[model samples]
Target: MRNHLVPVTAAALVAVSSFAFAATQHHATGSVKTYDSKAMTLSLDDGSTYTLPKSFKDPGLKTGEKVNVAWQQSGTMKMVDKVTIQK
Candidate 1:
């Protein structure tokens, strides 16, 4: 019984880890509509908005600037992982 329980627990852990790793990462390209430095949020022309992590720094982002954003969903928020200003 103990041996069976151990295998079952290990399998459950593996399933949970796989699900966590399978969270989709997304990418988008659009012109910036707004950037709130204080709020750490960015809105794009495509009607998508993202919340930047606190550790993220502005890369001279401004309204109407073209950018490519890489992000992933974290609970109810879309968290920005990377941002690149498009020339």
Candidate 2:
């Protein structure tokens, strides 16, 4: 019985961890509506806002420029992992 229980617990933990990893990354593409340098946030024309990581450097992001953002949701905020400016 103990041997069976151990396998079941390990399987359950693996399943739960898989779900966490699956939901950890997300992506978005849109034109920039606003960028607040002080707040370290970027707003898209679609109304979704993302919090840029502190280490993020200004990539000459401009208003109305199309951008692709790779990010993760942290609490009530979207934390950016990378930002790519579109041509």
Off by over 4 Å in 1: 1-17, 20-22
Instruction: Report the lDDT tens digits of candidate 2 across residue range 12-80.
Output: 999999889867889999999999888999999999999998898989999999999999987899999
Measured against the true structure, the TM-scores of the candidates, in listed sequence, are: 0.78, 0.80
Q: Which ten residues in a row have the lowest lDDT in candidate 1?
A: 17-26
For candidate 2, what is the total of clashing residue pairs?
Answer: 0
> Candidates' lDDT values, in order?
0.94, 0.93
Q: How close is candidate 2 to the true structure, as a TM-score?
A: 0.80
Alpha-carbon error at 72 in model 2, in Å?
0.2
Summed over model 1, clashes come to: 0
**What's the CA error at residue 83 for candidate 2, in Å?**
0.6
Give per-residue CA lDDT, model 1, range 30-85, as digits (tens). 99999998999999998988999999989999899999999998888899999999
